[model samples]
Target: MPHPPPLGDSAGQPGRSNRVLGRRGCHLPILPQQDGPAAPLPASPGDAKLQRAKEALRLAGHPGDPQSLEAVGLMLDKLAKENQDIRLMQAELRVILILPFLSLAPQAQKEELETLLRKSEENARLTEALQRETASLQAAQTELRLLREKLQGLGEAGLQRHRRVCPAGGAGTGPQGQVPAHYEGLAAALSTFFGSNGTFAHDRLSFVDFLDEVEDALEELAELLGVSKEDVDNFEEMALTQLEAAPWGR
Candidate 1:
């Protein structure tokens, strides 16, 4: 009834107050601690550092671990198989592409190609030989033409001289006429020269052989005529020219 003598008045009241405080004290809630048999977290900071050190050591020219070696071998084997497959595909493609050409090329075509090559080589050789022969023939022809022209010129000059020295007179002219005597003698000698005993005595002498004999005889006649060699040469050339101009000779 006195209000309990004022609550905080005595020293012995401290124990009673402590007990009240304990009853109303604040405390932290206790979490359940994860223990063994539970799934662990990822490696901690210190464990990660140790793992990195081990990786660095392994990378510094160290032998790979068994797992890494096995994985690498498997990768290399896969690459090798892939390479082989690619090579096989390439070979197959080549075969497919080339087979048609090979089949389409006839045996005869191959032979003809070889033959053409041989013929081309032969033709080259023959062409060189022909060129040499043609050049030689050309030179010979040039020399022959020059000789013919020289002979022709000399014959013309001789004929002119003979006409001056031995002028033929009229029909009644005597044997003393220089032209008449020379022609008569030449005709007689030619007839005798062409007789059976002559060099051109064959029944059917070639025109060339006949002419050669005639030219020889004319040479002798020119010497006997006491005329220049040019005169004889000119007379022979005139006879040959007349023969060549004859229709029968042509």
Candidate 2:
């Protein structure tokens, strides 16, 4: 058997360079750049070797079968495929504490991978739920702001009506000082109905400052009359005044 080629004949290049395999000096065999890195083939340990392979039938060579070259190429292709699968798998996975996965049992590895998957799914669900809750809170805040603005508007409107209805004076007056005929008649009739009590006297000129002043005055008058609770019209004047002057809660 022939010995392996010399490390160098006269050059500084790392591996043998010769015309037999082109100036791509260190590479085993020149093929295409697509397979992977063009590397030197591994040496066979002993009896198994390289130089003694069968050559392609049409070419001039030796002791192996016709399928040898094609078989070696297919093996390299399988190796390249395995390298690609490793790259793809690593993209989605990460090892904790930089530990090598191969050191753990196969079942332990499976459990670790499943735990990662379930945690990732739960994190996604929680993120989506938090976003929805945040949106609902923002909507409720907007509605509350609008309601507060509406309530403020109503309060301002009521205040404006009060100022218009009750101006800065002890009495109320509508337009000119003279009363209309029917309105004067109504006042005179009310005066005749109440008759000379003087407190309830309604005339062409008299007016109340507060809206509830007349009703309050009437209640005072009824209390002074010693009127029965159910029949206000029937009363003893002396008994009513004495009761009104008595200390309350006695």
| Candidate 2 lDDT over residue span 140-202, tens digit each | 999999999987886666555434433434243333321222233334544542335434334
Model 2: lDDT to the true structure: 0.49
lDDT of 1 by residue, 1-250 (tens): 4543322424745332312222355333445656779787877767864665555545544465666555556656765997999999999999999888976899998789789999999999999999999999999999999999987886677667566656767563433443434556555656643444433354766757767777787788776545576656656655544334223534
Per-model TM values vs. the true structure:
0.30, 0.31
* The candidate that achieves the highest TM-score relative to the unseen native structure: 2
Off-target runs (Cα >4 Å) in candidate 1 are 1-110, 170-250
With a 3 Å backbone cut-off (N, CA, C), the pairs that clash in candidate 1 are none
Query: What is residue 59's positional error in candidate 1, in angstroms?
Result: 59
Error of 2 at 200 (Å): 14
